[model samples]
Target: MFYRLMKMIVAPMLKIFFRPWVEGMENIPAEGPAIIASNHLSFSDSFFLPALMKRRVTFIAKSEYFTGTGVKGKLTAAFFKGVGQLPVDRSGVRGAGEAAISSGIEVIKRGELFGVYPEGTRSPDGKLYRGKVGGVARIALATGAPVIPVAMIDTEKLQPPGQVKPNFGVRPGIRIGAPLDFSRYHGMENDRFILRSVTDEVMYEIMRLSGQEYVDIYATAAKRQIQEAKKQAKQSGAEKQP
Candidate 1:
């Protein structure tokens, strides 16, 4: 109920303001379970994809969004819950992956759209990153759901990292590709090789659609490297100050 209400109220405002466009709407099945495997560009990727889609697409959000400690935290949690996002605890790497897989399987079992980012985290530099093999492939094989590759274009520009308000005059778009069927590897979700292959194929499709430069490293690792570089730069600046 809340999801529908929010969609009704918020979706149109987003559409008019952002002028977001989508291609390949017919690629989305009119009904039935499917995994929406998309490239993670910006935080707004979550908001725009769902608002523009006709059906409710549930994504696994980080648990921190739901467990904040202040008034803003409570409102954030409420908004996410109201929008029907499932929260997965990301403290433990292994546990978080398993929990996301389990949640995805349940969503697919109910014959609904389960959205996932195979890259596992938002791209640090707007480039497509190598996908982790655990979440999307494992769930798709486990539930026999087709994977739909979605590309969120120019979303990072709309609201870049650390920006509180979205900048106008930038038009975003979603490009949905035909669903990639993986029934040939049914019940082989445990095969690590198969998982990697499936994930890579999905990433390749996203790269093609979004036209993003492909990076073979995981997004998490890229973020870590970026943070380390920033720390080193700060240290060097302090040394020069003395």
Candidate 2:
């Protein structure tokens, strides 16, 4: 009920304001369980992808989004919940990855579309990063669900991190790739090499669709490098300021 209400107002506004164009939407199955595996570029990637889809896509968000304190926290929780997002504890728990995969399997068994970011986190740079296999690959092999590669083109420009409002009148592009089936690797989810092979293939398709440069390193590592570089620059500047 709340999801529908928020969509009623938010969807139209996004279409008019952002003017995103979608291609290969026919690849999306009309019904049944499937996973929409996409590259994480910006915060709005979640919002824009589902707004244009005919079916509801649920993505696992951080539990912090749902556990805020105060009136502002309540509103934040309501908005994320209304958008069909489920929360998982991403606080470095040993079972965090397992919990995410379990949640995805349940959603797939229910014959609903489950969205996942194979990279595990947003790209610190625009380049497509290596995928983390524990969530998407494990769930697909476990449930026999097809994986669809989705590309959120240039969404980073629309609403880069720390920007409260999106830049209007910018047209973002969404491309959906053909569904990938990994039934060949069924029952091999526990095999580390098989999981890496499956995850690499999915990231390749996303890179093709998004036309972004592929990076072999994980996004998290790249973020750390960027932060360290910034810190050094700041310290250097402080030394020079006599």
Candidate 3:
């Protein structure tokens, strides 16, 4: 109910202000369960994708989005809830992967579109990163749903990682690729090698559609290295100031 209301208000606003362009939307199944795997470029990717889609796309958000304190936190929680996002524990909790897999399986079994970022986290430097296969592959194989590769173009520029507000008037593009059938790997959900192959195939399609340079490292690992480099640079600068 809240999701629909917010969409009614937010979708038109996005269409008019951002003027988002969508291609291959017909590729999204009009009904039934399917996984919508896409490249995560910006926080705005969440807002833009669901706002533009006719069918609801449910993504798993970190628990902090709902557990924060204060009025700001409350508002944030309400917004995400209304946007149809589910909260999951990403704080190194044991069985976190299993929890996510179960949540995804439940959603797909209910015959709804399940949105996932196989890259695991948003790209740190605009290049497509290697995908994390744990949950994505399990859900797809567990439920036998087709995985559709989606490319969210120019979303990073609309609202880059650290920015507070979106750059209005910038139209991001969405390209929905055809459904990827993994029936050949069906019933092999427990096989790690098969999971990696399927995930890589999905990522390849996203890279092709979005036209982003591909990086073979996991995004989270890359983010850590980048953060460490920045910290060292800052320390060097501080020492020079003395």
For 1-242, candidate 2 gives per-residue lDDT tens digits of: 86897689877888888888999999999999999999998988877887778889988999998999998678668867887888999777657878888889999999999999999898887889999868888888888899999999999888886676788756898999999999988888898898899899999999999999998999999999999999999999999998
TM-score of each: 0.95, 0.95, 0.94
Q: List the residue pairs that clash in candidate 1.
A: none
Residue range with the least summed lDDT across 10 consecutive positions in model 1: 74-83
Best candidate (score: lDDT): 1
Off by over 4 Å in 3: 69-72
Off by over 4 Å in 2: 69-75
lDDT of 1 by residue, 1-242 (tens): 77887688768888889999999999999999999999988888988998788888999999899898788788677767767899987889899889889999999999999999999888989999999988999998998999999999999999887775888988999999999999999999999999999999999999999999999999999999999999999999999994
Which model is ahead, 1 or 3, in terms of lDDT? 1
Query: What's the number of clashes in each of the models?
Result: 0, 0, 0
What candidate 1 gets wrong by more than 4 Å, as runs, is 69-75
lDDT of each: 0.91, 0.89, 0.90
